[model samples]
Target: MNNFSSPKIILLEGIVNESGSLHFFEYSEALPFSIKRSFWITEVPQGGKRGVHAHKKETQVLVALKGSVKVSLEGTSGSKHEFILDQPNKALILPAMFWSEVTFDKDTVLLVLSDQEFLESDYIRDKNEFDEY
Candidate 1:
């Protein structure tokens, strides 16, 4: 659906096909950009906060494959929103220039699909710097 293009934070649909013990998530066009890199976050300590930053020019889709996680996003104008993702098919599309903080539950497994490759310079880690950037 590319909800990001329409000023939406999330896409409500995805394909879930389970065969025996394998489950597959198919996101054909739910996201605005094609994923160029994929990674998963695991072993996060309880009540841990990850991704306290904003991307300069990148997009990501976050999914909680195992357990629930809270994603809080801060807009450039200081607006904030939070989403709890507990399902694998429900993906949150976080656009660039939005500061995000992820709170993970115990035994949570978060899967990330990104449009761009890793570049340390692309991240704005400090809130003060993010506001100015």
Candidate 2:
């Protein structure tokens, strides 16, 4: 029902039939940015958290392949957005320079799609370091 107040939320097109349900994205059309790398995060213990950082030059799309995820994004300007992604067709778009924290529910699997490859120097892992930058 579109509970997210942030415009970063994107609802992907899905098809359901007797076989099952399918959700897909076209790189040049549906996605806001082209994908350069993709990865999956799973096996997070209870009350587990991740992504307490921000990127310097990367944008990402977070999708819940299974279960659910609570995502909180805060910009340097003190603006914030919170989202709960429970459906496979729902995704949250995170742009560069916004700090984010993702908390996972039990048995949740998160698929992350990035616009850039993994670069150590591009990560602002410290909240203080991110704020000072």
Tens-place lDDT per residue, model 2, 107-130, is 999999888889999999999988
Q: Could you estimate the TM-score for every candidate?
A: 0.83, 0.91
Stretches of candidate 2 off by over 4 Å are 1-7, 28-30
Best by TM-score: 2
Question: Deviation in angstroms for 44 in model 2?
Answer: 0.3
Put down candidate 1 lDDT per residue, 71-116, tens digits, no spaces: 9888888888888998765678888889999999999999988889
What local distance difference test score does each model get?
0.79, 0.85
Q: How far is candidate 1 from the true structure (C-alpha RMSD, Å)?
A: 3.2
lDDT of 1 at 18: 67
Clashing pairs in 1: none
Among residues 3 or more apart in sequence or in different chains, the pairs in candidate 2 whose N, CA or C atoms overlap within 3 Å are none
